[model samples]
Target: MKAWQATPPFGFDALRLIDLPRPTPGPRQVLIKVQAAALNYRDLEMATGTYQGQPQQAFTLLSDGAGQVVEVGAAVTRFSPGERVIGCFWQGWEAGRLSDSAALPLGGPLDGMLSEYVLLDERGVVPCPAHLSMEEAATLPCAALTAWQALVVEGQLKAGDWVLLQGTGGVSLFAFQFALLHGARVIVSSSQDDRLKRLAKLGATGLINYRSTAIWHEQVMAITDGYGVDHVLEVGGPRSFTQSLQSLHPSGQVNVIGYLGGHQGEINPLLILQRNARVRGISVGPRQSFESMNHAIEASGLRPMIDSMHDWLKLPGALAHLQSGRHFGKVVLRITAD
Candidate 1:
């Protein structure tokens, strides 16, 4: 088997493709022939040794992957050979609230699916939505599930409600699709006017080029008739938190999911207090949530927007593409034949 590992002195340059003995499943585990994997901002953070907490000395490098189950342990009953499945971001988190064990994430502390074959506990995988290809399914475990947790499970989004998406990255784009799927209107902001136009074509109710309008929240307020949006997918972390709060309606919720813009900034508590805001920090999601989102995706026939696909050997190039910030949606690495 072939895998990409983050070697010592963590950075993209340290990523190495190496051969290893194929892993075998133990009790209640499954061995999947990984077909595709997707990139996330966290992947970059981990590669660069910037992810919070002690970075792993060595580990595989991707949390989102999809493939076919090629073998299952004797006790494994949840899956069978040939079933298309996506690995969960948090291997130990099955249904409810998280625990210490849930902190053992893929692509960091544990070996991930950036390999030809990967082993997982039966509980850590979910059947892929029938409507999506392996590349599309690979986008769900992290980015799409984070969006689902923010907009659906945590935000409690509903028809006619308004949503504010910070950018056109995987999570934000998934939020846009899920918001529209629920019949809600979306306001999307990006630095590029052309990208905003593309989002407009995808049913975004309002678009703001943050590069042109520094105070994009003002435009969001104007679009909502001064009422503000009902939910904000706050992916920009400290750099955009104040503006996100400013763009929310009274009692609106802000689901903090990423730190693409920067990690440090000052925020006034008064801003949150004034709106009686509900601020929730979102992890990707648990396995149960993934299953629920998969069902919704299947029912709605919602296909993930894939910005580009790279062959597995082009992992470095794919990582560079993700770092370039030019991709409008998920950037995938096709690992093997589906």
Candidate 2:
């Protein structure tokens, strides 16, 4: 099988096509014939050796992927061969709260799904939503699931509530769509005016051009008639942390899901106390959340936004496209059985 491995110095430039031994399913695992893989910030971080999940020596590249099952282990009955599925991004965190000590995570500590075929614990693979394409489903496990968990699960977002999303990135866009589907008013902020216009067509009730009007928090306040937004799907790092904090209602919820806007800075502790607000640091999510997200996505007939799809031979180019910050949604790489 052909697989990709990340090497330092050149980052993802180390993607060399090479043959590797095909993996067999374990007692509770399933082997999948990978059809498509999706890019995330974590992949870029891993490529540059900056991710917390980076390997010590050898590591598998890429994480989120979707495909059809080729084989299943003896103990696995939930999924049968030939069923289309996607490997969970957080392999150990199956449901509810995360367990501190767990193993065999995909794309990080364990081998991931960035190849022709990959093995996963049966618990780590979920059926793709019936309405989504394999390429669309590949983007769900990490980015989309994380947004779903934060905006829907943790925040308890309700209709008519004002939901704020920063940037036009994958997670933010998913949140924007989910919030819209739930009948919440969406406010999307981006530095690019063109991107803001595009987001408007996607059901955002308001747009904040962060580049032209630096005080986007003020705009959020203005849009909500001074009540502030009810929930904030915060993807900005420290740079916009204070802004996100200030843009919320008195008892608002903010789910910190990414660190794209500079990682370190000082934040006033009084903000939370003064406003009675809650802040939750969000990782991707558990398998149960993935299942719920799939249900909602399938029911609503929502399709994921695809920025571009690259041939498996050009996976490096897709990673570079994600790193450039010019993309509006998930970048996909098409893989095939060889």
User: Which candidate gets the maximum lDDT versus the true structure?
Assistant: 1
**lDDT (C-alpha) at residue 171 in model 2:** 90
TM-score of candidate 2 against the unseen true structure: 0.96
Clashes of each: 0, 0
Candidate 2 residue pairs in clash (backbone atoms < 3 Å):
none
* lDDT values, one for every candidate: 0.90, 0.86
**Over the stretch 178-231, how does candidate 1's per-residue lDDT look in tens digits?**
999999999999989899998888799999988889888889999999999999
Query: Ten consecutive residues with minimal summed lDDT in candidate 2?
Result: 7-16
Candidate 1: clashing pairs of residues: none
- TM-scores, all candidates, are 0.97, 0.96
Q: For model 2, how does the per-residue alpha-carbon lDDT over 162-184 read when each residue is reduced to its tens digit?
A: 99998899899888889989999
Clashes of 1: 0
Candidate 1 wrong stretches, greater than 4 Å:
none
